[model samples]
Target chain A: MSMDFGGLRAVDRLDLMIHRGEIVALIGPNGAGKTTFFNCITGLYTPTEGDIHIHPPGGGSKRINGLKPNRVTELGLARTFQNIRLFQQMTVLENVMIGRHCRLRSGIAGAVFRPPHTVSEERQAAMDSYRILEKIGLESFVNDLAKNLPYGAQRRLEIARALATEPFLLLLDEPAAGMNPHETHELDQLILRLRETENVSILLIEHDMKLVMSLSDRIYVMDYGRKIAEGAPGRIKNDPVVIKAYLGEEYVA
Target chain B: MTPLIEIRKSVLVSIWFMFLTFPIMVIRVNTVENVVEWRWHNMIAIGAGSFLLSFVWRYMIRRKEQGIRRQREGAGPRLSIFQRIGQERRIFLPALTLLAVAVVVFPFLVSMYQVNIMTTAFMYIMLGLGLNIVVGVAGLLDLGYVAFYAVGAYTYALLNHHFGLNFWVCLPIGAALGAGFGILLGFPVLRLRGDYLAIVTLGFGEIIRLVLENWNEFSFGPSGISNIPRPGLFGVAFSLEAHARYIYFIVVALAVFTIFMVNRLQNSRIGRAWLALREDEIACQAMGVDKTRTKLTAFALGATWAGLAGVIFAAKTTFINPASFTIWESINILCIVVLGGMGSITGVVLGALVLVLLPEYLRAFAEYRILTFGVVLVLMMVFRPGGIVSNVRRTYQFEGPDSGDK
Candidate 1:
């Protein structure tokens, strides 16, 4: 996919892929179009050229270039924000329940009357959201407002909320951006467990080199809106181009 | 930060008071011949009164801060009496039940005039709740809500006047028409948000009223469709005082229904979508909420109750002119919602009661009632910007360790 804002190219023909049950990390310097690529794929911005496709586990692949953000999400792709976009006034559980909005079938009539089906569906959604929270270790803050959570827990809450959507592909934008070492370690364990337990594929944009090196099965490096290298962590670490562009030659040890 | 800065703020506030009070306070209406007269004494009185009020407010706030400091030092109660009352369910529930019982028995203990006023208040309560859905919950700023009210009232009035339809038959038709109008109004204004949306909605309201006033063939050209048939129980019609009582019951039932539906809608998946939309539209969409559909639902749902209230209002008054559904009516309903606390159902009810009944209670003040009302409203906004019954965030009952996080 390629995206151009006026005369400036934000993302230049980026071809990224995430297989089922794999954790793929996209690492790049600031302004290297990592987030722009995420935006294109998630339908926040319609790429000026090329198509982005999603292959749901039970379904066929379809082009999702110009689909609305919600429609793309409905197609089994969910994402978190770099700046933590959890609804601040809402409770943690409420935020996760909002993630379940697409899967639920209640309309105005069903909501008002709340027949047994609607009631059961709502209850099930709540239970599922709670389970996701528990998995992410945010079950204790279920009733607390998202804004009131500690920074580390707020970041984790965003992950739990994204997980509640039941997405086949989860795009996490800077999940460990502000986390300390212990929190980053916790996040690493969480992401690893997510793939093993939830059977979901993960794609993330990150700035932390240690977390990126530890968590990703495969790492893709970019520089100035172009992919410079893609390989296993061992190979990518020693790649001359990536070292010169991002890591620097002496720091490659 | 310091006493000097505080003093500077007080001076600025005083100047602002002078600027605000200069025009209205100086102008006087000569009632004997309906002539405009300038009253310097009145202006002086108002300026002085405003200055005193502002100073008192500043002093009270300073005192409250000192009290807070003292409380922090463990020299006094940690929370205020009002905050304690608010936090304690033991005191709150009984008070709420008493208020509910009082509302239920209000008509029985009062005269027909009071009952009539209570019925009007109930209609406002319903309208307030409806507007709350659009403005408070969905976070859409609507200034043309009276347009929906007008659509519903006119739908019933025209249908009854021309086709001779009963109230029951007209009610659904009116509500559907209102909802349709809601979608029509919602479509073009979806892209515009905040103040821009408010302006367009306001214009829509004016357009509706103007059309009603100009089209003599259809809306009777501001003369309005009169002799509207009152709603009945089965085939039996209510008489005199009983008519007010009966209409009161119907309105009570409708208000109750609005309360129930709105409460449910706020807690449902759709409701969460709305709250999310209100918080952050982009995030809401990214979370799989269809922004267009969600906003439209908010508009239509809010308009639905207003539509029902309009039908009852027409039946209750037995007549409605274009003047009845004015921009001020929309503003009044909005005020009730804001005053009661936006997005709060119980707040809307309390706001309507206080706003409507307070005026009736202050009828002895006669000409000065509006002046008092304006001052009270300003004071309420100053002291309680969140509103009288501001929405308390909902929390679930979890049997886990409670940390003093928030």
Candidate 2:
């Protein structure tokens, strides 16, 4: 689905489908509207015009055009902020646990009473949070405050938190935004593992072409909010429009 | 499980058990006048208990770490209770429920003076919890929450004194007025954040107070409003002949109700949105949290509680005054939120009770009381900046029915 802004068209008519377990990357230069497209898909901004459909594991597709972010998340779509949006004062584990908030059913009374069921539910959530933390290699930092984690770990913690939402489709806004080369490599591997092992379909916006090309099942290139080119990694890498819009024609060939 | 895990779990269980048992044990120890003297043996026993409790707590934390490690190694263990509860709502419900039970039963068990003190504490608790929602959960620093309290109190006082309206009738009106003012405050200041936001809120609070102080015709200026009607159950007024304890019970009940509702809102989708907003406003907006609505809701909810507290204050004292709802009162409530640990219901309650009661207990110190209070606050901030229970965190679980489990 492509969105058109007033004359400026931030996400110009782009058609894309990311099936379950696929890792898709949206890449472009600054003002490419990659983030805008992610926001549109995740219900952050209502596209000037486009239908964004999210089909959960169960046999149903949610027309998520105008839904609120939390509503979209509730419908099995979760995303990490471009900038880490962790409850900083909270511990790392707590950050991840907040993601499972959508799954918890106990109201105020149940939380206070700690009924047998509440206790069990809490136990399960904690376990799941830890599990996600482990998956992101953040188990060691679970008790540490979110703000105290290293830059790379903080990014991982954000991913862990998003995964905790149990979203069938995970939209990551620059998972490797501030990472070093080693951290980027690790993140690339983590994304692949998340897709292959967890079966989570991912839609990521990344500036790191090496990471994107290596990790994405398919690539969609955008500039000025409009799709410039879309194909396999190799094809997109060599596409004339993609090179001009993103890699710069002079730098490409 | 590894030995570390086993030891940690045991320690956690032990510490929790000790915490559960300490109050019961303390109940048996008789109070001497206003102070409880601890004999050497008692001190020793307390020390031992604390040591054991800490040991258990440490062990549980370590075990949790081990469990996490095992999971990373692809040998994850079964879910634990801590895992299920996660962190966010863990302390909220427990603290609220305990406070609820206490409030419900307090009138029956406590003395008149104690009941009176509890009523005031309950008011502060409500104010603190309300502020916690704005400043703690939403990460919006509001230094002017007491203005809402003042607006509520004055609204009720003016309406009831002039129109002969009952306290009950003015209560909702007071709350509405507070919320109105809250939204008004939210409009201009919502754009500002952090220290700037704080300054605006502070200025707003002072402006309200100044208006209340200057507006002689409406607020009676410095003399304040007096002879306010006390709340009655149905048509039955709480009187000495009947049972003044019932009035105390009513205030306590309101406190419990307020806590319950706040807790509910905090756990609901709104609460998560608040936290998300608190963590990152731009991101929250990016994630589809309507910034305007979330902020206004924070202001409205916070003001609603403050307004309700004002009603309770007016009724409890049978008097309303500008002095009672001052910026200092706002600071005190904020202190409770900070000292109790922001976004922590239990921490706020503990902070309120300690701050409110400590001065009363130190009344004999007279001149030194305020000084001591300041020192204590500084010391607490220095030692535990995150508040008394700062370790509490919000948690999430991903293993739902649709989890891509193998």
Candidate 3:
């Protein structure tokens, strides 16, 4: 997929793919268009050239290009922001419940009158959101406002919120950016467990080399908005082009 | 930050304001007399006014800084005395009962003029709550809200004038028409937000008022439809005092109904969508909320209450013209919602009472009333940026369809 802003090519004909139940990592330098690539695929930006397709498990593949971000989410793709976009004023559970908005079907009449179906649906939404929080070990902060959560917990809450949408493909943008070693380790376990237990595919953009190498099933490296190398983490770690562009040459083994 | 420096700054500010007002305040030209009147006293007053006001402004700033410091130190939010009373059920219940009793015996305690004023206050409470849905919960800045009120009032007036419909018959029709107009406005302004949304809505209100003024054939042009009979009981007549009391009860019941419905809607799924939308548009959309649908619903629902209030307004007054539905009318309702606490039902009610009744009771000092009102609003914003009672966020209890499910 390609994305352009005016005369600048933000993501230049980027070709990337993810299979079911795989943890794929996109590694790149600053301005390498990693987030832009994610945006293009998730309908935050419409790709100028390439088609974006999603094939939900047991469902036919369909193009999602030019769909609204919410429509993309409805098609089984969800993402967490690099800067953490959880609604700050809302309680943690409400943050997760908002993620369940697309899946639930209720309107003004249901909200005002509280019909049987609306009640059941609301109950189900709350339960599901609570369950996601519990699985992510954030049930303790359920009633706390999102802004009041500690930095690490706020980041984890974003993941939990994204999970509430029941995505087939989960995209995390720099999930380990500011985390301490222990927190990053926990996030690694959480991402792995999400795939194993939730049956979801993962794609992450990260600068933490140790976390990236340890977590990714495959690594794709990019420089100047173009892919430089792609292989198993071990092979990509030693690739000459990847080392020259991103990973320092001395780190190659 | 020292007091001396602050004093110096204030002197400069006062001088700047004096200079700014020089053209109009110091040199006022009398167009009819063909002479310019140099009112040096006006300049002196402004200079003295701003100089004294500047000290108060500095004091408020320091106090606000202290608040921020306290918050950063994790003292947590200090609940005001009003909030504490609200939390204490013992105090709240009896206070509520006392207020209810006062309302019940109010007409007997006061003259019909006061009763009518109280009735108008309740009508404003309903309008405040209605606007709260769109402005407070949905975070949609609607400035032309009076247009919907105008629709509701005129719906009754025109219906009564053309077809001889009664207030009771026109109430629901007015509400429906108001909602229809809300949707009509919603479609064009759905994508606009913040000040832009406010501007468009403001213009929409002006358009409605101007049309009412100019379209003589359709609306009888500004002289308006009067004698639109007050809402009546089943062919029964009453003394003027009894009728005023009856209208008071009607409005009180309507206000209660608005409170009930608005309270319910604010905690439901759609309400959550609105709150989330208010919090973040992109995140809300990414969460799969259809922004268009959510916005339209907010407009329609908010207008529903406005429509209801409008019908009661015409009935209570027995007259309404385009003059009754001015930009200032819209601003008054907006003030009630904002000063009351945007999403808080309690805040809106108290705000309406304070804003509406305080001015009425202070009629003895009519000249100072507006000045006092302005000072109070600025003080409120400085001390409690969240209105008189900020909305407390809702927490859902986890007990739905299946208990303890996987």
DockQ agreement of candidate 1 with the native complex: 0.53
Ranking by TM-score: 3, 1, 2
lDDT of 3 by residue, B266-304 (tens): 888889999999999878887778888999999999998
Q: For residue B143, give model 3's deviation from the true position in Å.
A: 1.0
Global Cα lDDT for candidate 2 = 0.78
Give chain B TM-scores in order. 0.83, 0.73, 0.86
Ranking by DockQ: 1, 3, 2
- Name the candidate, 2 or 3, with the larger lDDT value: 3
RMSD of each: 4.6, 13.0, 4.2
- The parts of candidate 2 lying over 4 Å away from their true place are A1-21, A48-63, A105-124, A127-144, A148-153, A177-190, A196-199, A224-226, A240-253, B1-122, B151-225, B230-276, B282-301, B321-332, B335-406
When summed lDDT is taken over every stretch of 10 residues in candidate 3 chain B, the lowest stretch is: B397-406
Model 2 chain B worst lDDT run, 10 consecutive residues: B397-406
iRMSD for every model: 4.2, 6.3, 2.7
- Per-candidate Cα lDDT values, in order, are 0.86, 0.78, 0.89
TM-score versus the correct structure, for each prediction? 0.88, 0.63, 0.89
Q: Higher TM-score: candidate 1 or 3? A: 3
Q: List the residue pairs that clash in candidate 3.
A: none
TM-score of chain A of 3: 0.97
Point out the worst 10-residue segment of candidate 2 chain A by lDDT.
A105-114
